[model samples]
Target chain A: GAGVSQSPSNKVTEKGKDVELRCDPISGHTALYWYRQSLGQGLEFLIYFQGNSAPDKSGLPSDRFSAERTGGSVSTLTIQRTQQEDSAVYLCASSLWMGGPEAFFGQGTRLTVV
Target chain B: SQQGEEDPQALSIQEGENATMNCSYKTSINNLQWYRQNSGRGLVHLILIRSNEREKHSGRLRVTLDTSKKSSSLLITASRAADTASYFCATDALQGAQKLVFGQGTRLTINP
Candidate 1:
């Protein structure tokens, strides 16, 4: 793809339900990132991936939040037993390589847990 | 907790005026980058300044880094209404933490 792509631009899920957000990064990019933004809030780092391995998962809010990237191309963020506070926009970004340079972002997935 | 903080949480300025946003971080960084977000969706990279470099420029954007003070600033010259959006600063920690930590963005509104 010419740019990072995220699926399901918007999602509304009932509390306690599970939702999955997907991301397809630019070709050949070795570094990927996941971030979350609440209503009018700052971007919160969730995870970072180099290749298919996540080097930093310290930002994951809780055990309910998990993510996986395969073949170093597409990634998925899964939020289990979602709560109302989990409502936010999940963003994905890719860079040529870890610490290589700037990152390209996807349009993001807006998840609303009601 | 490694995230940075942006100053003047919200700013409003007229078109053609210069707008400036500042960011401060708590840890040593290998580089600092500035990004712009429109409509709160995707973010576009604006500029990056290496720790060793004091300043850099891209078109109408100017970025400066003060590694000694662990701070950075973005200056948009002759701002346009189209420039109305949120600006963020991200840092690549020098401690080998390759993840980019972002600041609470500065929302700049340009009035026509």
Candidate 2:
């Protein structure tokens, strides 16, 4: 079975630029989540989507951080006006709802804001 | 914000030796999960223990949870050099809507 997949393994951009990271969840997975990992730091929750319900954006660091999961399958995380603090590994995960409770992760997109 | 804090930021052990890591978290949780990440790779789920359950096992990995103490521990038996990686503990807090709050992580180095 194919696992979660993310595109653009690495991205380098200037400050104030915008970047988009893409994630494709496994087939039949209904729960999707995005997290950030800074160097030598813990995983930081960013956003989550479950089915057609509203997405949880509480963990988003700022208004510049936004994510959208379209058609209940693929998702894109966009950081508008990126800052050096936003530079980190963006990870995507998918699960069969919380009932199953095991999340499959993607390789992640390493974003570098110079 | 991170809810869990792992002890011993780094550890080194000889191959075939056992290793243990502990995590302490604030707030009640629905479940506690352990994940392993190789260098420059995505995290892989190791084991999960519900707040109600005390312990879980997957192959050489063993996880124990103590809801009273708001803590959890992961023990790896007969660790191999390939097992060298970073381990993290994540908590599914009772208040959060199924989000996993992770700890700072422990870097394990298995010396062969």
Candidate 3:
């Protein structure tokens, strides 16, 4: 893809239900990031992947939050036992390289946990 | 935790006027970037100033960074209605792989 792509523009799930969000980063990009944005709040870092290395998952809010990237192209963010507080816009971004290059963002998936 | 904090949560200005927003961060950063979001859309990168740089400009956007004070500001000159959006400041710490820590953002409304 020419830019970062995110799936399921919007998702509404019952509380306690599990959900998965997908992100397709730009081709040849080596760094991918996930962020959560709540209403009137800044983006919260969730995870970061640099190539095939172990991801930086320090920002995952809880054990229910997990993510995986395969082939260094596509990634998935999984939330188990979702809570109402989990509702937010999940943003995915990709950069050609890490730390120095500019990043491009996806439209994001608005997750609404009922 | 949010490492950056933006001031004047909301600002309203008439078209053709200039708008300035300030951001403060806690830790030393390798670089700081500004982004803008319209309504519920994705963010668009505006400008980036490295720790070694003090100021940068792009079109009507001017950005300044004071690393000594751990603060930055974004200035939009001769704003237009299309410029109405939420602006955010993101910081990339010295030890991370560009994992950005963003501020709450400043909502700017340009009145016609």
- Which one wins on DockQ? 1
Worst 10 residues of 1 chain A by lDDT: A48-57
lDDT digits (tens) for residues B5-108 of candidate 1: 99989999999999999999998988899999999899999898999999999999999999888899999999999999999999888886778889999999
* Candidate models: Cα lDDT each: 0.92, 0.90, 0.91
Q: Give the per-residue lDDT digits (tens) of candidate 2, residues B6-88.
A: 98899999999999999999988888899999875699998889889998898999898988988899999999999999999
Error of 1 at B12 (Å): 0.6
Shift in Å, residue B35, candidate 1: 0.3
- Residue A60, candidate 3: Cα error in Å is 0.6
What is the CAPRI rating of model 2's predicted complex? medium
lDDT value, residue B104 of candidate 3: 88
What candidate 1 keeps of the native contacts, as a fraction, is 0.76
Provide the global lDDT of candidate 1 against the true structure: 0.92
Residue lDDT tens for model 1, A1-114: 899999999999999999999999999999999999987889999998997564588899999999988888899999999999999999999999876599999999999999
The true-structure Cα RMSD of candidate 2 reads: 1.5
Number of clashing pairs per prediction, in order? 0, 0, 0
Looking at model 1, residue A36 earns an lDDT score of: 97
In terms of TM-score, the best-performing candidate is 1
* C-alpha TM-score for every candidate: 0.97, 0.95, 0.96
Worst 10 residues of 2 chain A by lDDT: A95-104
Candidate 1 wrongly placed segments (more than 4 Å) = A52-54
